[model samples]
Target: MLSNPSFLVAWVFKARYFPHDEILNSKKGSSPSYAWRSIHNSLDELRKGTRWRVGNGRRIHICEDKWLPTPTTYKVTSPPTDFEDFPMVASLIDPDTRWWKANTIRSLFLPFKASTILKISLSYNLPEDRLIWVGNKKGIFTVKSAYYIACNLVDTVEGACMNGLPTMLNLTTRGVNSSGFCPLCDKAIENLPHALLHCDHAKQTWSLWQDCSVNLVSLILDPIDIALNLLEKGTINDLEIFFTEFKGACTSFSLHQNPSATSWRPPPLGFFKINVDGAATEDSGNSSIGVIIHDSHDTAIAALNKVLLAPYTIEVTEALALLHGALFALEMEASYAIFESDALSLIQSINSGVVGGEIGHIL
Candidate 1:
């Protein structure tokens, strides 16, 4: 820690001016140099996450004018070979002159603090465009590896906070059966490319997929190949959009239509996504409304605290349910609302303000 002049200066001597020896080594039971060594070790050990016994208490006495400049600037006429020469030059200068000189030089290097050192180490690990240089007795080191380690640590922390299940693996293919033909569409199982691109379904999706695949070929291939193909290549962004659309199509094709799926509803727009659901039981003379409001991230922001009173008309309850969600959002400081309903006619009625019919009047 004392290797740098700034740190030494900050600790043992005051700046702008020098400090006297009496003040620098004022503690009763220890030498001034010993006290400085102890402090420096204590600081260094802290960085390494180590603890040590501190013998002397934290009090030191020094001359009153600690930060004053040295009396003689030209005292050190030449660089002397031994450490003993420092004191001779220091004595010729000011009482705390040596400490100030040490610290002033120390500032040119990075600080001894752990955070500062870690930052310096990480800067070297980045790409040349992003890398930072740290100078020491050794040549400069890049901080890329340090940055990767820091990123890994941050990712671990974020992963812990997610509190969700691992993502499901995507199935891209079905292997050939005993007959040596594709299981998905009865085509020959020749090669991976043939299996992916030559199938009947694959043929239907290829024209669009090919246009998108051009963008990502470089990242999938080598830098040399990409450089050679630059003039004829499509951009990476285009492939990304194509992949997203293709994935959505695959998911859509995977779903099986069923009687229970008839009630499935699409999502809403705006800040709050209001879902309106109504139920009625004529035998029990009961009708209830449920309204759920979600944000753009699909998190439940608010719900109608109070359910609608019983025996209400189902259509009226549905309208009230949507209104209840809106009012709840308003109370929660929502500026925009998007109301969704499976009842398309009812939604149209509300938007159109159709006043004559049964559902229209209720909406």
Candidate 2:
């Protein structure tokens, strides 16, 4: 349980001691078994191992967790000024995008390590940090989903993991013989936002969607931003359906498709990220609002949930929920922040500088 903590084995030991903490934070009891102490020594070695399976990054330390992917301590040669400032790898991640903080990493570590860090593709589904046995070249003991996701990452452009199918523009950069424009409609240069969103074929495909046709009109943002809007405006099930349909559309567009493959990128460094959402009961004319504030370290600074007595449209409720959260943040003096919501229409209105409807004053 202590050494290979997974599922039930890890839970039992954790419950016994350090229930609210990690195995790394546990101490040997007064009369501990030989197994307990043995695991402690192994944990120390893994901490200094060459590669650790990255998850939410709440457990591993930055400098002291030298057993980075390279495993050769030479990767991150730059000495850390202080270990206390960033005790865990969580500080290295951006909570908003759920990806690594590139700027902060480049500023902190050497080029070799920083490059490795950036190449490490994160996942859209935020999972817990896991382990891959030392000397396991094939990552046999690692999470299967993450390994598959890593393979998919290769299909994406250098920076965007959710760029769908590479357009003629990217193909030309790779020395393929073709005009760098849309094949279906030769009017514009084909990029990620254009290939899957702005293209005439893509537009027609999305037009077929029934439940959320409004999203079809609001396809001005990148896929990642669009995903965030969907999550805030709709539910997980809704997002799943959208992605499934989107994948179909991309596949029909081209065989070289990389659809619904997403990675968590953290919000910008030194910025707090707030995720706001609302749910309403049509029968009761009541709604509930949820707001959570997290710093760059992925630590929740504050969180709140409120029940509204009156009924309101989904858009208005989401806007009100965001307003409530923003006010809460201001009360606590969290100025530099990136607010996130699933309400695409509300966000579009705010971004276009054309606030309207009931939430115009709030915007």
Candidate 3:
């Protein structure tokens, strides 16, 4: 059954052949033994060995060929106990089998034993620090899974398990349960659609951009399929918007989850970094806005400067610094300049294009 693809099909057909509750409860001992004994008696004819037929019973044969056809099966059974069994198993399997050449299959089997080690380490509450070195005799798969499981890390979102981390399968850890919540909104926890499309707040935001033309409700009904469709069509802009919406929804959810229910801060559009240093004691609020432009490298390409108007509030000082920098960039005939500030709200307000607020007037 393990060797055949057809066995899974047969499993569906034979699912009702046994009484499920009875099969689940029956054991070799502890309970009344009649049910198990009857099952034992029914299979008594094959007790001698599957290799031979005695009495009027069915017969079965055990050969590696029955499981694998064409090439005679190879055997390398005498591997050292400490070694991983896969290398030997792979060596035994037909060298020409398509699975043998695939990198995906190789990766899948390499961790067969590592997963066991991770579970053991996690069970005993071992220290959580340190990268799990693969193939180290000191480590196990179970412990590695535990370390990953605790952090809720996953490889690329659509992984069975994180590359070296554990998965939801490690249910032994605490505070995890099987509930479907929108990755965006957690309030009336349900499916992705409910959180991203059906949520009143989310719907309003999406409607603002899409104008109800995108069939968001239906798309949300099968977000995964819609997502794949977008990808396959190479609709990069739509995908970006979907991701942005999804992130917004999640942030909104996280905020509501807190006891005080603070509202979410929308993600910043861009940053303008402005660094200012001045000494107030020496009348050296001779502040200068040092504007440096670099092309993604720490090396400076251009440096420009301006004097400041205020030095009291580092807030006021930075505004003057940016104003000077902005005017300088304009004078130098540069198209745009990213203004940065240590004060978050000020930078955020400007980046968001919400000028005419208090900080806007001050600057």
Candidates' TM-scores? Answer: 0.25, 0.33, 0.22
lDDT of each: 0.37, 0.62, 0.36
Predicted structure 3, TM vs. truth: 0.22
CA RMSD, predictions in order:
28.3, 20.7, 27.9
Compared with the true structure, model 1 gives a TM-score of 0.25
Question: Least accurate stretch of 10 residues (summed lDDT) in model 3?
Answer: 68-77
lDDT of 1 by residue, 116-166 (tens): 111111111111111111111111222553344335424533432342212
> Model 3 over residues 309-351: C-alpha lDDT tens digits?
3223344445555655666555655454455445455667667
| lDDT, model 3, position 193 | 50
What are the runs in model 1 whose C-alpha is more than 4 Å off? 1-270, 358-362
Model 3 misplaced stretches (Cα beyond 4 Å): 1-187, 190-193, 211-213, 218-222, 231-234, 251-363
After superposition, the stretches of candidate 2 with alpha carbons farther than 4 Å from their true spots are: 2-9, 17-21, 34-51, 82-87, 138-363
What is the clash count for each candidate, in the order shown?
A: 24, 14, 22
How much lDDT does candidate 1 score?
0.37
Error of 1 at 231 (Å): 96
Candidate 1 vs candidate 3: the TM-score winner is 1
